[model samples]
Target chain A: MAEGALTAELILGTTEDVLRRYGPAKATVVDVARALGVSHGSVYRHFPTKAALREAVARRWLERWHEGLADVAHTDAPAEQRLRDWLSTLFEIKRQKVREDPELFDTFATLMRENLAVVDDHVTGLENDLAKIIADGIESGDFAPRDSKVAARAVFDATNRFHDPIYAADWKAPTIDVAFSAVVSLVVSGLSVPD
Target chain B: MAEGALTAELILGTTEDVLRRYGPAKATVVDVARALGVSHGSVYRHFPTKAALREAVARRWLERWHEGLADVAHTDAPAEQRLRDWLSTLFEIKRQKVREDPELFDTFATLMRENLAVVDDHVTGLENDLAKIIADGIESGDFAPRDSKVAARAVFDATNRFHDPIYAADWKAPTIDVAFSAVVSLVVSGLSVPD
Candidate 1:
């Protein structure tokens, strides 16, 4: 492989593939290089270290997970409806990742632990998306005026069980959807202006 | 020691000490037996297996943790006030455990994972306490008439981040208390019957 042709994105995709096949504990920078038909030095040029590579992979995966929700946050709908849709979409995305790609989900979860800054950034990004919708709600008089950022954080924290990976096992419960709906309703109710 | 002196409570207390000193992985039935000046055989007669002993210890610990909350659940105060007090108290108890005795807290968390049935039962017991408070609120017309059991579960799940061991690391953040109060206020607002 030509050295000039190897990019960070290319290296990250190969690393993700390596992680999927070998799992988090055994996957390494050398594996990514071998998969890319390049030397480990080439991969190092892109990621600098194994930790950096893992962090990049986790960040990219989390970024993709919330892209749809960002769109939902900005949709031209009633702020309440948009907030509901945004949260539901976010929950469904996480639930699907847990249910459908549990191996990859587990891999990212392990990576996320070692990459706390990336996880924090991802959470902050999602919270910002939530805050935008909440701010819109306040402007439209649908919700009571409050600190949108704080309200967003509260809403995000309130639904931790539905979206947080640590509670992934509980997501499969028969009543999980009902529980999710209940939380969303309560949160929306809490935000709504009293009639 | 007298044969009759080897009570289950004695064994459990010794086990907790052993666990706190040696941690969840290293602590064993033999250590508990050694600490109590009894044969491992005598301990086996009461707990049957190491797993059983660990489960019993975890159950006792969790039961103790919630004992005070059970009182708050049954208090004569306004249901809303009682509910807030119960939740805030529960959060404080868990936060203290995480901050003041992280090692012991971690050992219990590991033991709890191994003894999931014990964990589930403990959660159900706590939810029952919450349900009782919500039922009272409904009766007093402070909250809308809803399924108290379901509302209890929702409240418990919603506040999970403040109390769940996995999120313990985030508990020490400067804004955690504010974030927690925000969630509690949102939850209480959601439960109250709007005028």
Candidate 2:
């Protein structure tokens, strides 16, 4: 990486650390710069404002989430299996985040809320990943032929209760796993081509 | 109605008005009592506590929601049409509440959150209503044989994004209606018995 790019990467790492330590509300550009043993001006050169820095950190976090699911989307398994695995993996990833470090998870959620454009882009990317799996199912004659992109959106919306942040509180319900299985089964059945 | 029962009804009506005017955070038993030209002690005799009064108001609101959905659940239409209409009616009712008077809707949401038991009962009642429709579909040989209660719960969870209060923001998206239709179609197809 170029020298400036390397510095920017270091700044983002320190910002993540500061956010983890002090939370979104208290974390500041000065804290990140101080942690890096650099001046606030240096941080400002890389990120125009505090919000920009926070948005970058949130984007980085979401990028990791996408990367985790990308493998499942491209696996060689049958399309139906891949789709189930993909949705389950996504739900597990989100649930684990909440379980392991809810404070940090909430921090990123707040940052993401402030960065609506970033969230929109991330959602669109996820839909595209789902579309790829649905397209494969259609090609394999397992799923009914339809617009994969549209199908992907419908599936994503339908499963929102399992993975959406607002529903995080209900994630711990004893029957949540069963509910997740039921929903995935219904979606798979819905996609199956009728005999 | 008996005199005490009448007084209790009056107290609840005044509580609703007070909650709507001041929002959940500021509304109090004294406010309700004052609005009804009764002493705070009189309100307490009916509700016992401010929380009790709030819970009653929230329960009343949810009761009305159930009443609205009860009609679609019992209609003479085909099971499939009734299911679709029931789900759509729920989405429309919730969306209208949010759109027509967002402040009051939010107030009720706050009250509902504070009263978890009331929320749970309300959810169970909705799921039962859905189960009735699913049971009818099964009886008519339109839907595959399965536990109607389980299928109802699954359908309810699958369509959470459409009616859940937390997703109120997305309800306004231009494509939301199309998305609702797609989900409902997928659900209906999922329930259909194969040859």
Candidate 3:
């Protein structure tokens, strides 16, 4: 079963690569199969149609992103540290993907915006987790009584906005890092207990 | 001379409309000249090439933006009120552009990013203006002593980030206003002088 899963993962990765290169309109099952050096029949065995293949690829990518989030969600790190790590992870992924192909970055951004409903559940879960950590900090007297939900949303939006340049492959990491640190520090200081 | 300047301005507006309808790659000088119901030779009299016409349209847009800033820079409004108006005007213009044509947004954003040197200078001027206001507030015992440069950058980035959805045509005014207030309150609360 493990070997089967690994094969499936590899096939999905290849499918996404083809999709990114050719766009959804031209990225057919046969195209993916050809790129993977596999028979069309073998591709059909895994994904019955092009739509199914695309759906599977998107789901796989979201699952991988969630898995990364899960890895850090419950770590023993302080709340601020966790938030920074999460923001950094997001930027790193975006930057690496942008470096791979600018068109792919645009495609991914458009897909995410157009299909927010598809990932709503995962986003909600992440938001809840973030809010809980923030609330914990407040309860422990480390943070002020700012609205955690609003704060979390601001952090999410600010970080995502900074990824625009990254998606366009025009980002300077140091400058972006400075912007990121400023945002994180400002928010944290705003929420910190009075001296 | 005034008549000539008015004709040039009209031609610029017509060209912007045409370029916005069809992007620079597929858009043509003939199309713009035709749209304006002017002779192709007339357009050639003003702009030698399609590239020159596109650049003029972009320059006009930037000029209008800077003019708005200059008009408000010497207003007698308090620092916070001036800051809010500046942000609002910036976003209102973006929202108007998105409403005019969604596709034009990508064109504008792309042009702005590609010309970051010019865009950065505009932002730096705004930041310097904001820093002075912040410094005045500090001296007047309304704000705390924080790194004005860093703090100004944070305010600029956060407010600009909030304008993303407006440019995308996915934001409501009330929601964005709430967000604007949140950032403003966060900054003032975080950096305000204690009584």
Candidate 4:
């Protein structure tokens, strides 16, 4: 990486640490630069304002989420299996994030609310990933032809309970697995083509 | 009706009026009682605490939502058609609420956050209403037999975007009706028994 790119990467890392320590409201550009042992101007050169920095952190965090699900989408597994595993993996990733460091997860959730533009882009990115799998399924004759973009979103929204932060409280319940399975199976069966 | 029964009904109705006028935080039993020309103690006889009063109002608001869908559940239409109409009605009801008086809808959304117990009961109640239609489908052999309760919930969760408050911002989009139709058709197809 170029020298500037390295510094920008460093700024993003330190910003996460600063956010973890002081949270979004209290964390500042100065705090991030100080954590990096660099000048605030140096950080500003990379990210012009606190909002820009926060948006970058949020985008980075969400991109990491997509990273975890990408392999499931790319695997040689059948389309139905791949879609099921992709959703199950996504749900597990969100659940683990909440379980391991809920404070940080909660912080990011708050940041997500403010940075809807970032969230919107992240959502579209993941949905596009889903659309790719559906498009492949259509080509392989594993699924019926339909509007893949809209179909991908429908699949995501259908399984919202297993992954939506609002229902994170229910993730630990004994019945959640049952509910997840039902929705997954329903969607898969719904997508199957007649022989 | 007995005067006491009448009193509880009066308290509930007045509580809603006060909440709409003052929002959840500022509206109190005193305001509700004053609106009805009754003492706070009289209101307390029906609802012992502020939380209880708020719960009653929320329950009432949510029950009204169920009431709107109950007829669709009971209609002579086929199971698939009934489920489709039920979901469409719900989305319309939510859209109407959002468009007709967003302030009231937003107020209930906030109150819903604080009163998860009320929300839980309301969810279960609505899901049960859904389960009834699914059960009828199973009995009539129009649908496959499975766990009706769980299946009902999946159907409900799949179409959540049209009705969930978190996605309320998207409910007004021109494309929302298209999305709703897609998910509804998918779920209806998912629930169909193979010929």
Candidate 5:
């Protein structure tokens, strides 16, 4: 990575660490700067305000989430397995984020309503992509032609529901795979019709 | 109903109304007593403590919910139609509650983590009854046995997940019905195997 890109990643990592240890209310750019052994001016050079820093963290989280999705989307694997892999990755990311940095999780939930407008377009894009892939499967005789839109939404909603429970700072991966498999089986079999 | 039962029912209704108007933090026994035009002592006679009153309200909600499930479970109707009716009633109750008694919805959510103990047994009972009915259908060749426990839990969990957006005081029944139908269809098809 370039120098600036590397610094940004370092800043993001330190910011997440401070937030997890001290919570969003107490974690500031100064804290992140001090943690990084850098001056406040250096932190301010990259982030003008605390809110800006937090937003950057949020953006980084979103970007990483999408990257995980992209990994599954581009894989040369069966659609159903790809979908499960994607879900497992998504849940694991959420689980780890919560376990490692709970303050960010708290910040995310508190600000999700505010940030959803910015995030919705990307989320909608993902949902649409997944829907189209499922639809393709149905068309190719690999799956049944169900209401791909609704099926896609159910998968999206159910998988997201695991985030809150699985990411409790004292986290456990209990039932994550169980719930994921149940929903996946439901969707796959639900969509498959006999020839 | 007996006299004591009648009084309890009356108090439950008034308490729900008070919680609806004010939030959990503000809804107290005095407020409920005032709403019912009764002395605080009369309210106390029915519910000894504020916690007791809140528990009663939660219990009442679960009772009504299970009553709805019981209606469908005991019916001599087809398994498919019965499942559909049960899910529709579940979703519709959430829809109407979101609009009419948002306070009750709030109460349910506030107690969701804490007072869920009250509903645990009730939910277990409902799940058991549901599993038995589904198992009976499978034995009778009316439906396929595709993990009745998961299906029951899915129906239970999905109802909560899908209606959350609705219960957040959004009254979008059409979208909710679409999601609900998709989940139901998934369960139905997953369980259906060729003879």
Candidate 6:
């Protein structure tokens, strides 16, 4: 029923609030239940265990970024432009996540460390998005002939510094915008057909 | 005077043995002194604190890598070949570090996390070695006009998957070499002056 769907959505939304206030180490389902004014049993009904609850929270948080990236990947623009927009969208989403809800972002960062399988799926999904764009480019003759899968992974790894939380501290650096453009130019040029 | 020098060298060598035998968190100055069969006071004379001792060991271990990189950076060969060699050398070194003395490497990884200044200097030094090669390429017109420092950083960042310890787990992934070459080629092509 739609009521069941609303219950899960309400739990995930309240979970974010709890995590932001108490962080991963201390946040609990009871906290989420209290935030939602529901019994702890109700929270457990949605997520079987604490780990499941946390993992679902982590998955929900990550998918929001993917949704933005999906829009850019499937855009009607040229493949090259779509690739650029994809990277730009990814960078902007990460930067905004850090700036807008730093505490929640920090909580998810810890959750990511705790849940590698979730992180792996998230990375696989992102790389697949990149591959879709590169595949389009290869098909249109805009990109050099190559293994689109390998090339997509390379592009993802290449631009990791701009998006990975590991280098988040450098995002605010003064010359970062220039550096981002230079790297993007290099990537775009790399993919283009030789003159 | 040479006895004093030998004492410091002996302490450092024993510290490496101690750390390898018992990981970083458990290793201590007294343990290091005991390994060398010397008074702990003597170790303190050389390293004022446990942190200082660990910092020196980390610096010493990291410098060995830099020394190898420096040879490749300043090689009499062409800049493009040197760049290739440099990346190959880095991948091999990181692979060897994990394969050979994983415990010491693990200890240093933790030390690096604990000591940001050392990590900063090490990164700056590595980037400088990269910049030197890039500056040479720019001078010889092998590379296009741009900020050499920025380009150097991008190159370093681009090849990070092959070298950075954080991604050590993926270094052994099937098709990683293909991914590595794709990225290296992309970066090299990006840097080259168009025909």
The clash count of every prediction, one per candidate, is 0, 0, 0, 0, 1, 0
Over the stretch B19-75, how does candidate 3's per-residue lDDT look in tens digits?
678775677888877887777778777787766666667666676755666445447
| TM-score for each of the candidates | 0.97, 0.95, 0.77, 0.92, 0.77, 0.88
Q: Higher TM-score: candidate 1 or 3?
A: 1
lDDT by residue for model 5 (B1-195), tens: 233443888989888878878877888888987887777788888788988888878887778754656677768877767766766765666666666756566667675545757867776776776676677677678776567887676556544554443246435545756666666666677666644
Better of 1 and 4 by lDDT: 1
DockQ of 4: 0.67
Clashing pairs for predicted structure model 3, backbone only: none
- Writing each residue's lDDT as its tens digit, candidate 2 over B160-184 gives 9887787888898999999999899
Candidate 2 wrong stretches, greater than 4 Å: A1-6, B1-6
Q: Is the docking of candidate 3 incorrect, acceptable, medium or high quality?
A: acceptable
Which of the two candidates, 3 or 6, achieves a greater TM-score against the reference? Answer: 6
On residues A1-195, what C-alpha lDDT tens digit does candidate 4 reach at each position?
Answer: 233554777888888999999987899998987777767888888899999989999999888765768878888988888998889898999999988998898888878988999987877877887898998898889887488888888787777787777777778889888878888888887777855
Q: How many backbone clashes does candidate 3 have?
A: 0
True contacts kept of 4: 0.65
Give the alpha carbon lDDT tens digit for every residue of A34-147 in model 3: 887777778787777766666666666666645676556567888767766766676676677677776776656655554556556656666676677677777777766578
True contacts kept of 3: 0.29
lDDT comparison, 3 vs 6, better candidate: 6
In order, candidate lDDTs are 0.88, 0.86, 0.66, 0.82, 0.67, 0.82
User: Could you tell me the interface RMSD of model 5?
Assistant: 2.8
Maximum-lDDT candidate: 1
User: Which is the better candidate, 4 or 5, if ranked by DockQ?
Assistant: 4
Stronger candidate by TM-score (4 vs 5): 4
| Model 6 Cα RMSD, 1 decimal | 3.1
Per-residue lDDT for A23-115 in model 2, tens only?
888988989878887778888988999988888988999998657698899999999999999999999999999999888888878888889
**Highest-TM-score candidate:** 1
Model 1: how far residue B44 lies from native, Å: 0.8
The order by descending lDDT is 1, 2, 4, 6, 5, 3
